[model samples]
Target chain A: MHELPILRSIVGVALRHAVEAGASRVLAVDVKVGELRGLDAAWIQSYFDFVTEGTPAAGASLRLKESKALFRCRSCGATFPPGPHAGGDVACPHCSSKHVELASGNELLIESIDVV
Target chain B: MAEIRTIDIKEAVLSENAGLADRLRRRLMESGTFLLDVMSSPGAGKTTLLLETIHRLRERGIRTAVIEGDIESTVDAEKMAAAGVKAVQLRTGGACHLDAAMIEAALHELAPGDYDMIAIENVGNLVCPAEFDTGAHRRTMLLSVPEGHDKALKYPLMFTVVDCLVVSKTDYLPGSDFDLAALRAEARRLNPTLTVFEVSARTGDGMQGWCDWVADGIRGVADARDGALDC
Candidate 1:
């Protein structure tokens, strides 16, 4: 997972934001990560705690919101949400076509950080 | 009592790495250099295939250099040096992937004027290497037949991000239960524009196609810079 580096950046960004806001401590970080991004939210929280130790972001919890991806069927020209059984092996449900394209949901963005 | 507030920052997770990569890419464009970032799992024949490509290109008057990334050894760099190319070794001491910062450091050590293309052989881990942008104009990956076709399905991110996927070790096609068609289909399903070549670096099978594809990337970079100057 790239979470170690990404979470470390998150901590840095959170602390910077907290300082800019004149807050004494950071409480939580809200992030929007894609469903297919392959990051473990629980692991990110644990790592964030460990990495942020001595910083303003110490003890801050990571609040993750999984953003689901959209798939477009290249065969039938249809767009749909990637269902539960979605992956390389998955086909378009509407047309049963294997030629599907990932339209969105590879994003990993920091929405906001709560600070006090 | 302290004032609590929520700061809206909406920045990308890998922005730090991507920012460095952008600088490197700009430098490469200005210098008319094409960098190929190659990634694969350990023992996917990345070294062998890359060495062979270096050899072939050298005979045709094209100078190529390498930046080899490993956990902690000079073995691969030694091999590249013996092959008579300018080489730089980046020993991460234990990191699984090579980030743009590492590339920036290595590029400083490497003589940019000495080569037309710099092919970076990233630390051999499919998962983590794909996540970091190493400032390459083109990104490619190798998946050996021995690794099995299910790899693309399992490691979808790797398959999704790569520009090309070389199905290596085609010489062992008879021994392994590798389904070529299914693997190609699966990879295509993930990334429609991914160019694939079934290659056997040991036997020199399918090397020409790989070379041509790489030449295209090099030429594209060269032509783009020239076109910009013309405009």
Candidate 2:
């Protein structure tokens, strides 16, 4: 699955940053995933553990934070979060305009690495 | 417990791949080649549609090439080559999608500057390919009539990421409950700027519009190159 490859990248980034910071061990990797990505954190963590074995980040925990989808209206120029069923209908709440663009909510970032 | 020090590394997980894709896109623009990534579920007529589209493009004196991404077989590549265009096959073995690095390697093999357009038939999966950027100038995907219109709801990311949506297999829409209007509405909700075409590659219906859109892209790349040359 894609999670394995992405987790491998996470582990690689974490270890590299850890080593550069002169840390002896990595404690955890903090990542931010947007809602649109729909990635399961537990699934990614399992893959992270599998790939990080015998590395400095072998036992490091993965901390994933999900960000909600945000849309910016083209007409009213207002940004707002999607409704209850975000995927189904995403219109501007302020102007009720359908001409809205996805401003964020498709992010997959490694924010930081906790090392000691 | 040892003192924990936080190392701030605000980097994207696929930053390396994204960086390579950006560089490859710039290189393609400089070389006057329009790269198109074609994605869809298996058996959605990507090969059929591409063959026909390439034929039309060649008829208009636009050179075309193909890079096929399959999980294992080289069947599609062979077919493209038989149609009289240079085709390269990238067998991913077990991987589900093609990344930027693979495209970069394939470009070296393709010597892509010789062609006006290079289309990548990405591995037939809706999910993974949507996440990876393969340096394509435009990403178009097919949703065959048999796949149902609700597919846009099921695979939202795929719908959102694509530049164009081609509803293939219209020949099968006779008795099927595949609602084209509903699919368009749902897909546009996700991506309002998406260009959509309903075509049946089997009967050659709606193929001209699709080909024209692609030709426009190829001509745009050539125009950009000319503009750069003038500078």
Candidate 3:
């Protein structure tokens, strides 16, 4: 999976950062993945385990925080969470208009790393 | 005895990929190739449309090559090559999408200055591909008639980021229950300036328009680069 390479790169960067910060071993790595990002946490963890082998973060734990999809209605000017539906139809709770634009939930970030 | 300290290193997992994509953007601009990245779901007829596009561009004497991204196998690349164009396949092993670094690597393997246009056919995934920019000058997303018209709303990012929307499989419009008006409305709602095209790659209906757009984009790139050289 492309996630294997991408996760490898992420862990490499994190390990470098941890070592630079005077950490002997990274205890944990916290990452935030958005609901719409379509990243599988289990796969990412498995890839992390493979990539972190022989490094200071070899046995480090991975913590994933998934964010839910949220949207902002342009016509109603109201922000609401995305409903579990296939179509992009989101009735504005305020104006009942179905013209909503996504606001968040596409985030992919390494929130924090516990090292030393 | 060990000292345990919890450190906060808030960084993006895609930071490296983003950096590599930026590098690719610079390289593509410098190489004077107008890159068009296309994305859609499996069986959306992306390859079929691309074949027709390549044929039309070749007829007009435009040098073009394709970088095909797929989870596995080089079937699409082989198809492109058979259609008389340079095609490179970047296998993602099992990844759902392509990234900048992979494209950068593929670019190094190919002759960069040999083509005027480079079409990067991203993996058949609507969500992840939209998040990663692969140094394309323009992004295009295809939504076939059978795929339903609600795609724009369901995957807003993909629709919003694309400069053009190709409503493929127009021939099936009569038999299929696709709401053409709703699809156009939703796409325009997400991207007000998106150019929409309705075509059947099999019938060659809208190939000319797509070809003309590519020509214009290539000329624009050439003109800008020549002007910079003169300066």
Q: Indicate which candidate wins on DockQ.
A: 2
- The share of true interface contacts that also appear in candidate 2 amounts to 0.64
Q: Which candidate leads the pack in TM-score?
A: 2
Any residue pairs clashing in model 2, and if so which? none
Off by over 4 Å in 3: A41-54, A68-103, B1-8, B59-61, B70-75, B91-96, B150-161, B182-195
Q: After superposition, how far is residue B5 of candidate 2 from its true place, in Å?
A: 1.8
Tell how far residue B229 is off in model 3, in angstroms: 2.7
- Show where candidate 2 strays beyond 4 Å: A83-91, A96-98
**Candidate 1 lDDT score at position B81:** 87
Ranking by lDDT: 2, 1, 3
Compute the lDDT of residue B154 as modeled in candidate 2.
Answer: 80
DockQ of each: 0.49, 0.54, 0.34
Q: Is the docking of candidate 3 incorrect, acceptable, medium or high quality?
A: acceptable
Colliding residue pairs in candidate 1 = none
lDDT of 1 by residue, B77-180 (tens): 99988878788999998788999999999999877766779999999888888778889999999999999988877787788789999999999999678988
The per-prediction i-RMS, to one decimal, reads 4.2, 3.6, 5.1
Candidate 3 lDDT over B19-124, as tens digits, reads 8887776676677777889899999999999888888888788888899999899999999888887888999888888878888888876787788889999999
